[model samples]
Target: MLGALAQAVERLPPARRWLVGLSGGLDSVVLLHGLAQLGGRVGSPGLRAVHVHHGLHARADAWAQHCQVLCDALEVPLDVVRVDARPHRGQSPEAAARHARYQALADQMAPGDALLTAHHRRDQAETLLLQLLRGAGPAGLSAMPRWQPHGSGWHGRPLLDMDRPMLEAHARENGLVWVEDDSNGDLGLDRNLLRHEVMPRLRQRWPSLDTTLARAAGLQAEAQELLAERAREDLQTLRGEAAGTLSIPAIRALRRPRQRNALREWWREKGLPAPNQNRLEALLQQIRDVGPDSGLLVTWPGAEVRGYRDSLHAMAPLPLLDPASVWSWDGIRDLALPELGITLSAQEMLRLHGLEPALLEPPLTVRLRRGGETCRLRGQTRILKKLFQEAGIPPWERDRIPLIHAGDRLAVVWGLWCCDLPAGAGRR
Candidate 1:
């Protein structure tokens, strides 16, 4: 088992720091102990462990303490991250907790760091089964990869190919102790139900059940790679004027399966959740009949896909920014616009014409468009709507753009345009 672990660790790309996701469970305890034994072989900056305190179970605090004790014994650094694991609308408790745990881990990671988790063959098999039950596609059936780039760094499962019994045997040999999560016995949970009841019965019929399912997942991963490659090639030609947007007509030119594949890949690239079959089909249907002037929007869960002009845009649901809302900003300090999910940097104002040091004596006002606003740009008096149309900014995005006003005169439009401001406009 130690040899297998060493080989797996060596196979991963070298990282400056390695953070172990120690859950105080048998699997993670074994992983931490094994890696500690290898010493200096894990990462250049040495090994550290992180325990996510999900606060879901009653014994959550106890679990964190157990992890700290083990880390102290191993003489490795440990960090316990507390997170809100409460489920949001349409999200399962298990999924919410998992998301929160990973998000907390991601927040601490730096570039060139790698997070190691003790996900073994059985876990991979269970994941495959769960995805299968959800009627997922190749990407979902791929389960977890052994190594993949994650937030600011990378995520690795070094002991992924190892089985549960092997880890249990190692724990016994080393006299290692781990805390048992009482939640594991809750058959109400899908994974727990599979682990305790379904798996045992299935193993009776096929002794190599875990290995076989893991192998199937590996094959699906390979197929997903090919599909993703095809999608990338398709997207190269289907790209819209914007970087991440897709051309509507170009997408319609592809066959149905290829279109679905391309759309899924596009969503993946944008870090948005892949829409389910029904949603994807609905989006595709909209794309087929969508006119250049159509305001077609297809939404699911955390994301929305909209067709505007000749492009298809996928983004997180736009925030509700009341047009009446206004902000005051000093020219020298960076201004954060939480409602718009952006920061207006002090340096960005340098691009605005005629806004010299003398003009900034009075503070600037920022507001969203309420429509019927007009501004003179390059000596031409144009309506804000016409300027937005000329700029190719979609109607959905126009309302979100921060319109900077020098007194009552529109001076800038965030990244879009720097309007012509009259001399001493704000000081008027």
Candidate 2:
């Protein structure tokens, strides 16, 4: 197992640090020990152990303490990140915990660190079956990846090829004690039910179920890679004038299957969820019904696809901020607009627009656009709409621009047009 893990680590991009996710379980304990032994002989990178405290179970603190003791014994640095893993409405507790665990792990890693987990072959098989039951496509059916970008670094499952019994034997032979979560005994959980009941029954008939299922998952991964490559080609052809927008007529030229594949690839590129078959059917109908220069919005949980003119844009759902909302700002620091997810800084006076530095005095109000407003850009009193149109700003982003005012005079606009130099302030 150590030799296999070493080969996997060597296959990853150059990393200066390694973070091991120590879960205080038999599998992770064995993994940590194997890595520690290798570090002593070969002078490995800065290796540290991290235990995520999901705060969902009654024994969560005890589990953290157990991981700390083991890391101390091995003389490895350890970090414990506590997180709220409460399930949202219509979400499973297991999914919430896994999401929170990965988020916390991503936060703890540095620029060139790799997060290593102890997911073995049996776990991979269980994941494949779970995704299959959920009607997932090739992307989900690919199961756990061996390595991928995590935060600013990388994450890998080094023990992915090892069987469950092999890790258990190593722990027992090396006198490594581990804490077991009582929640695993509850058959009410979906994964527990599969592990305790369904998998055992299947193992009785087919002895190499884990190995074969994981192999199937690998084949699905290969198929997904090919599909993604084809999608990339379609994207290059269908790309519109903007970064995210795609040409509607270009997409219409492809067959339905190719269209679906290309759209799914776009969602993946945007880090959004792929539309299911039923949603895709509705989306196709909507695309066909769209007219020139029309505004249409199609939304799912985390994504929204909007059409304007001859282009289609897919991104995170646009936020709505009041144009009448106003706040007082001090000129000493950058002002943050929470609703719009942007910040206003004084350093952009000359960089972004022709604004005066002295205009950002304290007690000045930060306002949002209320329409019918005009700005003097290049010595012309132009309507805000005209200025935005001339700059080629999209129609959707006009409302999100923040208006900076010093008393009654408009000083600067966020990422758009700016006013001329104020009376007392010098021009750049």
Candidate 3:
């Protein structure tokens, strides 16, 4: 296992840090130990262990403490993260918990860091069975990848080829004690039910059930990759506009399965959640019926699909806007809004002020337009609404455009106007 771990680390992109997800379970404990033992030979960049406390069960804190102690004994740095795993209405508790756990793990990883997990062959088999029960297609049945990008770094399941019994045996051989997660036995969870009930029965009939299922999962993964390649080609034909948005006309021309396939591929590329069968069908129906003037919005738990002017746009669910609330900005210096990654600076404004006949002669204030506004441009005073239309700006962008005002009067209409400047000024 240590030798395999070394090889996996070598295969990863050059990294200065490795974060081990230590759950204090047998699998994670063995994984952490194996990595620690391999460290001297493999020459790691750095090592740290992360333990997430979901706080769902009474033993959660104890598990985190155990992980911290184990990390200390292994001479590895440890971080304990507390996460809220409470499920929302109509959401599965297991899914919510997994989401919280992964999100917490992601938060701890920096760029160039690799996160290692202890998922193995048996776990993959269970995942495959669970996906099958849910009627998932090949992609879902493909189980977990050995390595993938997570947050600012990468996550890998190095022991994915090893079985759970092997990890347990390793822990026992090394005198490692681990916490037993009570939730693992809960029959309410689909994976738990499959593992505790269905898997045992299958193993009784065929002792190599885990191996057989893992092989099947590998085949499914290969098929999924081929399908994904085809979907990418379909996307190239159907996608339109600068936003990487999909064209409804082009998608509609494709067969229904191909349309859904292409859309799912697009969603995966955009990092948005893929829609289920019902949602995809509904989206197709809406796109077919709606005209250019009408907007179609379909929202799932974490993502949304919107249609505008024969184009389809998929995105993570955006916060609802409160029309009454407004953000204020001063025009004197560069300002970065951390929430939006938007920067507003006066470099251009100052350059304009330096020009002959001064393009922006200001005591300027930057703000969102609140309607009933007017501005003067090129020897004529016009309604702001009309100016936006003449400038070919979209309606959604009107409120977001930073309007530069001088005291009570609207001055320059950023990137669109140099009001009050002479006709021959040649603004910067």
Candidate number achieving the greatest TM-score relative to the actual structure: 1
Which runs of model 3 end up more than 4 angstroms from their true locations? 1-15, 42-45, 86-90, 326-330, 333-343, 348-372, 386-394, 402-404, 412-428
lDDT of 3 by residue, 286-363 (tens): 877888648688999889877766777777776544334444445555756433335656676545543322234444
Return the candidate ranking by TM-score, descending.
1, 2, 3
Superior by lDDT: candidate 2 or candidate 3:
2
Give TM-scores for every candidate, taking all chains together and pairing residue i with residue i.
0.93, 0.90, 0.85
Candidate 2 lDDT, tens digit per residue, 316-426?
888877678997776547778889888776666556865544544444778877888788867777788888877767677878888877767777777765676455542
The sequence of per-residue lDDT tens digits that candidate 1 reaches over residues 144-195 is 9999998789999999999999999999999999998888899999999999
Quickly count the clashes in candidate 2. 0
TM-score of predicted structure 2: 0.90
Q: What is the C-alpha lDDT of each candidate?
A: 0.88, 0.84, 0.79
Ranking of all candidate structures by their lDDT, best first: 1, 2, 3
Alpha carbon lDDT of residue 185, candidate 3? 88
Q: Mark the regions of model 1 whose C-alpha exceeds 4 Å error after superposition.
A: 40-45, 330-333, 345-347, 357-364, 378-380, 416-428
